[model samples]
Target: MKLELLASFFLLTTCFTAFSQEKQDTAVADKGLIKVSVMYPYAEGKTFNMEYYVTKHMPMVAAFLGANLVKYTIEKGLASGIPNQPLPFMAIGTFYVKSLSDYQAAIAPHGDAIRADFQNYTNIIPIILVSEVVN
Candidate 1:
């Protein structure tokens, strides 16, 4: 009986330790910097042109900013609850940066280039939001 109890206790402790370690790993994985660019297009254009910008201009901007572009997703607003008319297409660009200052410095040189590129594309100014990953 004593041996069985000891074995159960050891197993329980091992399982608990494993669970704790997994939680810590998850926490660490969730801690990172994310920069999001919410891209909106001008109302008077065809979706084809917006798609072209996403395919062509996005890559150039990402490269110029020196950010690791993780993913780019296109989403449409259904029930977003925002005041403005729902954007036809919203391009979300996710980038990971080491720190806020690092992110700012990396994209600082590309400001003029970004503006120039935007002028060539659409008049709709994109909203950029930078956030730190917090779980």
Candidate 2:
């Protein structure tokens, strides 16, 4: 009887340990790794040439930012919550980077030239964010 009790207790502890690990994995999956993002929001009556952005600007970004840039995504804001109203933003650009320091180190060297090309695309100053992905 004592041996059986010991065996059952061991099994119960093992099950709880496995359950704890599964819960931890789920939490991690719910909240992803840390990352950096650079977002460009639009303004009213702003002159933004999407053609130039896609052709000339993005290529320059990829070339200048270098390999530390994990990835990049481009979004065009369609409509806001209010019905029959224009969206607050026209376009938002996101860049997935390793960290703030990594981005600064990689792109600082080319900052001058990279910034200089801004006028060729849009007039609005971009909103940059260095943050983690928690979704």
Candidate 3:
């Protein structure tokens, strides 16, 4: 009976932890007015240099993107819902901006340089998305 109670307690704690983490993740997503996401899709067997991305690539983005870059989030996808399944994306990067015009203006001058840096990190082309934060 004691062992069963302990197991039940552990399960409840785990569930609560997962729930709170998911809530926190969603809250982060809701931040800022405009968001620009660059998602690198996962392949069956491929390589991505995460070290270079975080260290070199992101710093370059911040320097070139300028002060208009309100904030940014970089995510390294681990796994899918199902156990042992691969994640749909290798990495997902979001840049928070105040407006579309601001983002366009800031990125315009640096677009070529930003594109050029991709090879230093990963060979895969990322899919980009620009969206308004609703909520």
Better model by TM-score: candidate 2 vs candidate 3: 3
Question: Which candidate would rank higher by TM-score, 1 or 3?
Answer: 3
- In model 3, which regions exceed 4 Å deviation? 1-32
lDDT by candidate, in order shown: 0.63, 0.72, 0.85
TM-score for all models, in order of appearance: 0.55, 0.66, 0.73
For candidate 1, what is the lDDT? 0.63
Q: Please provide, for model 1 over 71-135, each residue's C-alpha lDDT reduced to its tens digit, 9 standing for 90 to 100.
A: 44454434335666655544444555556676577678888987787766566677667777785
User: What lDDT is reached at residue 13 by model 2?
Assistant: 100
Residues 1-135, model 2: lDDT tens digits:
999999999999999999999988865653543454445665677767778877787777877667667677677677777997767666766666555676778778888887899888888787776677665
Give the candidate order by descending lDDT.
3, 2, 1
Off by over 4 Å in 2: 1-35
CA displacement after TM-score superposition, residue 51 of candidate 3 (Å) = 0.9
Worst 10 residues of 2 by lDDT: 29-38
**Model 2, position 24: C-alpha lDDT score:** 85
Query: Can you rank all candidates by TM-score, best first?
Result: 3, 2, 1
